[model samples]
Target chain A: MTPALDPVIHPIQRLRICALLDPVTEEEFAALRDLLETSDSALSKQLSALAGAGYASQRRATRGGRSRVWVQLTPAGRRAFHGHVAALTALANHAGDPD
Target chain B: MESDAVSAREALDAVSAARELNAERLRRPKRYWIMLGLMLAVFALLPYTADWPPLLRYSAAPALMILVAVVAAWRQPTAVRKIRLSGRMGLQLVGFALLGGVVIAVSRGVHLEQGWWWAPLVAAVLLFAFVAGVGPRMDRSWARRASHGEE
Candidate 1:
């Protein structure tokens, strides 16, 4: 049987974001944005979606007189991300095989 | 590319790439190994200096430790601002504590029985093994664990 993929996390941008956050405990918002090569508003929008779904969390703090935001994946998010990756791998593995 | 256009193959690639990136960032810098080597050198040599004045011999190790701490602080970032997902740091702390405790116990017991003339040589060999072999192997293992989503 094929594994079920998470539709919510199946989007390219969301998949990339989840992939990036899955490894680190937390990442700086600006760094994620730069890495994703997306604008502030766009990244915020995606983060908002993930937050709404309880897949990610964010915190704001002031450092060196500058406010910074950091983002991290929740436990639920990690499980979901790993599961999605597993599904992806399963799909890729079967890409050339007969049913 | 549109979200709908992304295939499972591409998603897998992205995950692999991201893991690689984090592995690189989370890796201890080369200077970290160098500092560890210097610290081990100081520790390994201290056991052999049993003939010096008690105060001077005892003070030398602490002084070197303070120097290493000061240098690490001065060179490394004060606040990394990033969360470390790997358990390597915790493992290193535990490993060092256990190793130090055992080494001190053995060296002191041997010194009481006779002269622990071979303490320094044993320590040097053990530290060489740890730094050149155990350390990198542990790092790679932890990095693999971290990359696999095991925090």
Candidate 2:
């Protein structure tokens, strides 16, 4: 089987979320929604998946008289992302080897 | 037969994507282990007979860096999830930097009387400060990621 077959993070949106999140410590809610090109509902769904898996954290705060939200990888999230990527790489490697 | 064919195609695509992601995850651990192993090996070569002060100074960096890296490797992402700008940790980190700087200056003023042993300590503190201060701001996208749970 390809390394991507079994992953700590599976869903495409969730993986995309991790991809965007892996680089920075935290990111803005609306800004990310724009980048992901996903609706608020779609993004929320993916975020919930990650949060439920203990891979990320979310917080709600207010600024400039408006509600704001933020998200970041927890230590566990980082580990999981790292593992997921590893799983992906392994799959890729296996495909090429074919031995 | 069209629906059946479509189902098979979807399964194939899903499997391929999963493989790709898993492969990427392995890269980090592989690099970490190789680097860590090399460092451990190099440290083992330091003469057992070196002077205490110099040894302490020299050992400070590699020892601490390796220790920190290992600890970070071991930490699940959940462990650092709650990092926040609480006044206490912020103050403590700032305090550490201030203390290190003051000592470094004082030692220099003493005509280098104090072995620059604390330099490595300061570097470590600086590294930690950068991570603590900058890490959160950089990965802010996780907010959206976490909220967009599953579809």
Candidate 3:
């Protein structure tokens, strides 16, 4: 079966976000922002896009009387991300092929 | 779009590199194991505190664990996101919990405290096996998965 690329995760920022979230069960929003080196609004925009596509989810909780957000990929998100990666691998493998 | 500009291979490599970087940077330090070691030491020494006040002896383990957790958290704030116990590591933990429980039950049932120091010895051995053996191996396996884009 062929793996299809997911347009939702095609952007570099979203792709990197998915890659980071792929291994972890959950990630703090602040930590993710720091790791991605993106502004809060930029990260939020990407997260919301993924979430709207049912590709991610976020939770808000209070820690030390301060609110914190944690994000994670959904099962659909994992499938889509892996599918996209597989598609990319396939493309990469054939990129230099001689016709 | 930027995706159109970057070759598929380059994008894949970038993603893989990011994954590896995250795995390497976010992994728990040896201090995490040290905290575990300290906790085990507390448990191992608990039974020997026969002369201490009952209240202090009973509460010591939880208190020490809390302190260790706080210190470990402070020392490694990244720990809050990384160091997840999953897959083989998760199974190993379940096995450890079950075996540890059985050992405790057997130790108390047989009254080995009178002459045999089997409980502490077994605890130490299991702790060593986990820290020195299974734990690192599990981390390696998890890192491989992370780098390879495995779920």
Best by DockQ: 3
What local lDDT score does residue B17 receive in model 1, on the 0 to 100 scale?
85
DockQ for each model: 0.44, 0.03, 0.47
Which TM-score values does chain B get in all models? 0.66, 0.32, 0.67
Candidate 1 chain B weakest ten by summed lDDT:
B77-86
Q: Write the per-residue lDDT of candidate 2 for residues B71-119, one digit (tens) a residue.
A: 6567443223322333444565487556545544553444335455544
Best by lDDT: 1
Report the interface RMSD that candidate 2 achieves against the true structure, in angstroms.
Answer: 10.6
Q: List candidate 2 segments past 4 Å from native.
A: A1-8, B1-151
Model 3: colliding residue pairs: none
Give the winner by DockQ: 1 or 3: 3
- Model 2 CA lDDT for position B45: 28
In CAPRI terms, model 3 is classed as: acceptable
lDDT of 3 by residue, A16-50 (tens): 99988888788889988998888999999999999
Give per-residue lDDT, candidate 2, residue B51: 44
Candidate 3 lDDT, tens digit per residue, B1-151? Answer: 3343256877787797778877786555666666665576555545555568999888877898899878977845544435445566677668766665665455444445465556666655565455645555655666666556544
- Can you rank all candidates by TM-score, best first? 3, 1, 2
